[model samples]
Target chain A: MMNYGIIPISHLQLAMSIILVLMAGLVSAFLKLGLLKSLIWGTIRAFIQLSLIGYLLAYIFQINHFILILLIMLLMCYIAAREATRRVNVPTQEPLLVSFLSLTASSLLVSVIVVTLIITPRPWYSAQIWIPIFGMILGNSMNGISLALDRMYNEVRSHTAEIEALLCFGASPWEAVKNSVRKALRAGMTPTINSLMVVGLVTLPGMMTGQILAGADPREAVRYQFVVMVMITASAALGCLLLIGISYRKMFTEDLALTEDMRQSHN
Target chain B: MEVFFQFTQITHQFAPNGPFIHASGSLQPGKALAVQGPSGAGKSTLLRILARLIKPTSGTVIYQDQNWQAIPPRYWRRKIHYLPQKPVMFEGTVRDNLKLPFELDLLGKEGSLDLDKAKLLLTEVGLPLASLDHDARTLSGGEAARVALVRSLLIDPEILLLDEPTAFLDTETGKKVLMYLANWLQNKKNRGLLLVSHKENNLAFFPGMQAVVIQSEGTRG
Candidate 1:
C-alpha cells in the first residue's frame, strides 16, 4: 500500500490566507478600481459558504446513507437550476422547469456513469464519492445550460424575421429555428470543447489540483482528473442538447408562428 | 361570384386594454382583395391572420371549401404565403434563397425549384440574370423585396398575403412588382391576392380589386 501523508492545515494557517486577499485589495485601492468592496464581500461570502459546505459534507459522509445523499443532490440541483434560469435575460415560458430538467438529467446521468462505471467506489452509492462528484458535474452543467438557454433565446429573438420567413415558406418550428439552434448549441459547447484542447497545457483544473494538494499520488490524481474532464464535457454537451431540444418550441406559438413576445426586440 | 377565400368576424386586440379591430372580407379567385386602412388599424394583422401567421382572437377562415383549422399550419402557410413589409434575406445567394422552400420537408421533391422560371422572374423583376448568384444579404432593399416576392411565387401559393410589398421599392419598380403580381393572378389557376398597402395608388394597378377596411371599434366595453 502506498502511503501519502496528507498535510493538515491549522486554524492559524487558514486565518493567514487573508493576507493574499489583502494584497489584492491593496492593488485595487492603488488603481482606484472600485472593486475593493466586491473583493471584501466575495472573500467573506466564500469563507462562509465553503465552511458551511465543509461541515455539511463531513456530516453527510459520516451518515453515509443513500436517501440522505439523494436528498442533498436534489437540493443542490434545485439551487443550481434556479441560478441557471436567473442568468437568462430573454423571456421564456417555464424556464425553471426546463433548466431543472436539463441539469438534473445530464448531471445525474454523467455522475452515475462516473461513479458506477469508472470510479466504482465500494458500496457504489458511497456518499463521499457520490456527493462531490455529483456537485462538480452539476456546477459545470448548470453553467453550460444557462449559456445555451441565453444564446438560444437571444438568437431566436434576433432572427425573428428570418424564422418567420421560413415559417411562411412552410417550415416546421424546428426547421425554422434550426440555424439559430445550431448557433446556440455551438455557443454552449464551445467553451468545454476549447478547454478540452488546452486542459493540461494552459491551466490545471480545480479537481486535480485539490486531489494532489490533499496528497493523492500524482498519477492517480491525473487519472481522476482525466475522468472528470471527460465527464464534465459529456454533461455540458448533453445538457445543452437537451435544453435546446426541449426549449426551442417555446419560441413559437401553437399556430407555428414566431411567438409575439419573441418578435418584439428586447431593448 | 365564386368566393375562393373568406374570413368572417375576425377580431384582435394588440393589448389587453387596447381597442378591438374588426375585419371581414372575401377574396375571389383570379382577383385581389386590397386590405386598406390607416397605419395602425391592423391591416397587416388582418393579412397575418389570413396567412395563419398570427391567430385572431376570434374568427373563422374558409379556403377552397375547407376550414382553415382543418389544414395544418405548415400546409396553410405554404398555400397562403405571407410576405412581410421588410424582406428577410438568409445567409446565401439569391439562388439558394429561391431554392430554400423546396429544401423544407414539407415540400420535398413536389415543389422543387425551377431555375429557368427563377431566372425569368428575376429578369421580369428588372434584376439581371446573373443576379441569381449574387449574395442575398448584399442585395439592396428593393432587390431583396423582389427576390422575396419571387421566392414566394416559386412556392406556388394559392393566395398571397402581401404586407406592403412595395414599401421598399421606388414607384416605377413598385408598379413593376404590382404588374407582375397582376399577371401572376391572371396566369395561374386558383390564385388570389390579399394586399395590404398604405399607398392607394399601388392598389390602382390591380384593376377591379375589392377592398376590406379594418377599423378599431374603441376600447373593449
Candidate 2:
C-alpha cells in the first residue's frame, strides 16, 4: 500500500548532514546553555562510530565466515554487558559474565531457531539476517536486564529490614527475595509488552520502516516484525530471570547470613 | 544443663580497622540475658550475631555443642527467632502476619495456620480477637511489636532474640507485655530469651535473668 523503494544517500549528501548538527549547536550557543561543545563532540563520535561499523559490516558480509560472525556477536554481547554493568549502582564481579551468558543464551537461541527453523536463510550464516536480528534482540534484552538488576538491588537495599525479617522467620535467600525478583521481572517485561500494544498504531517501528525502504514486501516485513517482537519479549524475560537468579546469590554469604557487611559490600 | 548456644568473642565493626570492641557472650536454656549498654555500643549488633542474621568479624557461634557453621541458617533461624526493634508490617490483616511462618520452607509442608492458637496469643497480649481482622499497616507501633512477638512465639523457638520490643509501648502496656513474656518463658523449659533494652532497671523484673553489659570501648568518646 505504500512506496517500498528508497533513494540511496550519496557521499556528498552525507557530508551535508553536518549543517543540521551545526544548526542545533547554534541554538545551544544562542541560549548560552554551553552544550555546543558536547553537541559537536557527540556528532563527531556518532559519525566515526557509524562509519566504522558500516565498513566493518561490509567486509564481514563479504566473507560470511561462521566463526567471524560468532566472534562479532560475542563482542557485541560483551560490550552490551559492560554497558549494562556501568549503568547499575552496585558493582559485582559477575555482571559481565552474567550478562554475556544471559544475552547470548536467550538471543542466540531465539535467533538460531528463527533462522535455521523458521526463516532458513540461505547458507544459514547470512550476515544480513544474522547480524541485524541478533543485534536488535540482544540490545533490547540488555536494557531489560539492566533495569531489572537495578530494581532488584534497590529493592533489597531499601527493604533490608523486611527481607531480614523474612530470613529470620526461616526464609531462604531465594524465598526472601522471591517477591522482589517477580517485581523485577515484571519491570523488565513491561517495556516490550507496552511496545507490542501500540506497535503500528503509534508509529512505524524502525525495523519495519527499514525493511519497507529496502523494497521488502509489506506482508513479509510484517511477518519478520512479528517474529522479532515475540523473540524480544522472550529474550527480555529470560535475560531478567537469569541475571537476577544468578546474581542474587551474591547478596548473601555462604553461611546464608544477611550481614551488615554484606549490605555495605554491595553498595 | 546443655549449653544451648556459645559465642566465642564475637566482634563486629563498621570497617576492618574501625575502632570498636568485639561483643562476646553465650546463652543457655530456661534463662534470660539482658543486653545493656550505652548508645552506639553495638547492642543490636550483638543480638543480630546471636540471631545468626549477622556474622561477626572474628568469632564463632556454637549451638547445641555443634558449630553454627554446620547448621543451615534457615534451620538456625527457626530455633532462634530475631525480632527487630522496628517491626516490618505487610499490607494485610493481622492474621496474614501470623500466617507468615507457615509459608516458609523451614516449616515445610507440615506448616499450617492455627487460627485458634493465634487468637489465644492475641488475647494473652491484651489484644481483642477482633485485632486479628485489623489491617497490620494501621496498627500502632506497640501493637505491631506485640504482633511480632506473637508471630515469633507461634514458631516456638529455643531462643527468642528481642530487640527493644517494648520501646514504643506505654508504661502500662510495656509492663503487661513483659510480664506476659516472662510468664510465657517460665512455662516452657530450656527456652532462652535474649533481650536488648535501654530500660536497665527493668532487667531485675525477670527472675533468674543475667545482665550482660556491653561498653563501646570508648569509640565514641
Highest DockQ, which number? 1
Interface RMSD, every prediction, one decimal place: 0.8, 1.1
Query: What CA RMSD would you report for each candidate?
Result: 2.4, 2.1
RMSD of candidate 2 to true structure, Å: 2.1
* Tens digit per residue, CA lDDT, model 1, B41-136: 778778778878777899899999999999999989999999988899988999999999999999865858999999889888888988888999
Off by over 4 Å in 1: A1-4, A25-41, A90-92, B217-221
Candidate 2 lDDT score relative to the true structure = 0.82
The lowest-lDDT stretch of 10 consecutive residues in candidate 1 chain B is B212-221
Q: Single out the weakest 10-residue window by summed lDDT for candidate 2 chain A.
A: A258-267
lDDT of 1 by residue, A64-170 (tens): 99999998898898999999889675564788888888888999999999999999999998999999899889998888888888888888888888888899989
Report the number of the highest-TM-score candidate: 2
For B92-192, candidate 2 gives per-residue lDDT tens digits of: 89999889878887775656878888888888888889988999999998899889888988888888889998898888888888887888778887788
Query: Model 2's chain B TM-score?
Result: 0.93
Per-model TM-score on C-alpha atoms: 0.95, 0.95
TM-score of 2: 0.95
lDDT of 2 by residue, A207-247 (tens): 99888888888898899899888889888988888888788
